[model samples]
Target: MSFYNMVQSEKPATLLEIWEAISTAFTHNQNEQFQITDPRHGDFTVHIEQYADFSVMNNIYQPRQETLHIPIRPQVPSLLMSFCLSGKPGLSGDRWEASYEANQALFNVFPARNSTYVLPANTQHEDLVIKLEMHTPFLEEFTSDSDDQLSNLLYKATIHEESLHSLQGNLTIDQTASEILAGIQKCPYTGKLREVYMESQVKLLLVHQLSVVHRLQHSNKPDTTAKLTKADQEKLQELKLYLESHFLEDHSLQSLTKQFGLNLFKLKYGFKTLFNTSVMKFIDDKKLQYAHLLLQQENVTVFQVADTLHYGHYNNFSAAYKRKFGYSPQLLRKG
Candidate 1:
């Protein structure tokens, strides 16, 4: 095994230097999973599976000394989506650095990319990375007739080296997306069948994330009417992330305003203006949508799911679910 020790203050090593240290340094047994405990590499069991369409890398590691440098070929013309299933790992890219904190889903596309993830000390980290490589024709067909940021990402990366924040999209792993992600982890197929299942599921997950970016892109355009500055709008975006992470908790408008440092009017009105949904409604929808996923399981009853969601009354949860979905909560199980 090979190991390189370096302090954090030094300049980041180039990708080639990193590869010499880690990627081919150790010989792994031909199993679905293997161990990499080469001191500086940390102690981790990794499952790196490559299928016909895309690839998945599942790493469960505990922090040791020295930051981890992962080196490999750049999967270009692809959307790389990463999830921190557990632990709060700190990640910094050689180039495209956005919010790489744990519990956040960050995805972006480029012709080539490099990243280094520093798993926090004393924490158990489980991260799943999904790379959806695309062909020229497939991406071309998908982005045609659209001038959205996604299309802009494809066009910009083709000619330039700079990365934009919007294109380096960061998001919360909401209920539905989480479900899709779970499906990927528990995929049952093997061989070519496994490839097809993974490809389809990853595509679905990408579409789900794209829909979110598309909505937020349009909803957050300068109100032209409100006195909100660009900074205020950015804060509102941050506020949305906060709400998504804590939507199940009981939070009053006053408390939320204080937490986000927005006044009563902007907390209510600006949320409405920027997100196109009231704060309370936004929270309620997230709750009910999560409830929908839980109810789909035959083992869990509606009341049990509602209680887990902190719903004070079963009737209120059911009514809200019915209102949003146009059917009673019981119908999902029956169907």
Candidate 2:
């Protein structure tokens, strides 16, 4: 086969069957310490596993001293995404290392497997693996950049070290853990839903992880003269803080423009470009944050906070807060 496609076992698979399938799919060679098992689910046996000293079986083989190496390349070309459910390497020889806890996920494109590979001795590798058979066309659609090349998106050896650090930290499971887990659990890997579900989950996870890293790495980044400048970004941040502080005040574009010496065009574009949010939308977010905080106040009322935040009506504030937090503010307050 040109690529490793989905495996739909007619009957439930055993440990040995799963082992052979995994070996044939991922590693080209590895030490005996490597292991695989059946990850049992409702009426299904998926190849959810962990292995040590994993590498390509094609050429020479190098066994890891302590850490496990996950050779994601199959008998064919593929894209691999993994989450470190637990365990991490203390060090990585590869310039790029994605070290995230349960909150993070990794994305990499595998051209093919090699016979020899090495992993750090200090890091323990335990991860949840997802492999997709080589799909040149689908990859092109998903990738942001156009390139007829094989590259590892998860680990870029030449990327900035600080960005790598932030990426690793951000990949771990965090606020969006439930959404990710739910998406994975619901993926059927068949028919119409297969690609759609897989693509959605992958994109969401990747976007979230990258967004966090981007924020950490360039929180105060300036806008370019050709585009938005750094000063423009700083002004936007200041504007956001101001909105949060005076959410209840009259915040029309005209009022803000007059006070801040910003034109309507600049205000609209600058807020969107710098903060990735609209002016009124950002104001709404601040109101929500305040409402969340106000829930902690023993004597505070939802309507009172809503009015203080300049919500035209109490229901509007409640609905918005509910939509953002997934629960009614009053209910949250009572809790």
Candidate 3:
């Protein structure tokens, strides 16, 4: 079957094993039936559940009914982005519900808990799912100081209804999704050019998302840091080496300046001149580069990398990871 068509007819023999493979590939969670690598940048796994007709028993004594998981919830905090390829999906919670027809999309942001969904008996659902985990930097940038901030941010993380209106561009839905999907597919996109492109696309997505949230009204202005001198570029290379060795630790401007014996202002200015990003952004970028390398290993945990990098917590790390890389740390773990 095409990679995109991989499906679970029934639950896998061992849910954990299946989850492991999915985790290795997609690094995110979903309701049991479907899993996928993000196609946005072409980066994760693809899991699906296709039903010509299906059902389940309810209340311990309803009837052998044809339904998908009648009442299901996602196990992770994700912004579920889906594009309806065909058929219709009936979604309900107590009294409020809606049907999403083919050619439309349903962006559902599921918090830490599940949405009590009742899929209609006759409904057939099909779509491309992009599972999102919040980035640590994003969370830290806006949340570190208070619980109320985190709560408000989390509740509002979902893509707003207005933003989901058909993307207005020359690219078709498949084209846009495929472009992002391709980026995701390029695992370990190394080299300076590749890294720049990867990071750039991610930043674009973030800016796009912020615009959706109305927090960012315009796209980011171009970066205009000065050109780096050859000497500074060499120093930056050394600095990156240091970051690689100490990927799990917190780094600061003063510490780096002292270690390199360079003036603090000069170091900061040179870093921007050379990298076209702030020193902290460069540090975060290197951390992300290392995290991508770690993701190649089968046993690394998302939290481990967070702790190694001195992230206060996994969620914090995740937010930063997403902001810097345009994807989630959890997705890497899934792969």
Which candidate comes out best when scored by TM-score?
1
lDDT of candidate 1 over 195-287, digit per residue (tens): 788878877886676665555556746432236554665677798998888988889999988888888877877777556578999999898
After superposition, the stretches of candidate 3 with alpha carbons farther than 4 Å from their true spots are 1-65, 116-124, 134-178, 181-335
All candidates' lDDT scores?
0.64, 0.50, 0.46
Candidate 2's TM-score reads: 0.39
**Residue-pair clashes, model 1:** 0
Predicted candidate 3 versus true structure: per-residue lDDT over 49-130, tens digit per residue: 2111111111110111343233444444544454444455444444345555443444445444433333333334444544
Give the lDDT of residue 254 in candidate 2.
89
Rank by TM-score, highest first: 1, 2, 3
Of candidate 3, the 10-residue stretch with the lowest lDDT total is: 54-63
Query: Which residue ranges in model 1 land beyond 4 Å of their true spot?
Result: 1-32, 37-41, 71-78, 88-99, 110-117, 134-138, 145-169, 221-335
Number of clashes in model 2?
Answer: 18
Model 3 whole-model lDDT (C-alpha atoms): 0.46
What is candidate 2's lDDT per residue for 157-196, written digit by digit as tens?
2121112333333333433644675666556577666646
Model 1 worst lDDT run, 10 consecutive residues? 22-31
Q: Report the Cα lDDT for residue 315, model 2.
A: 92
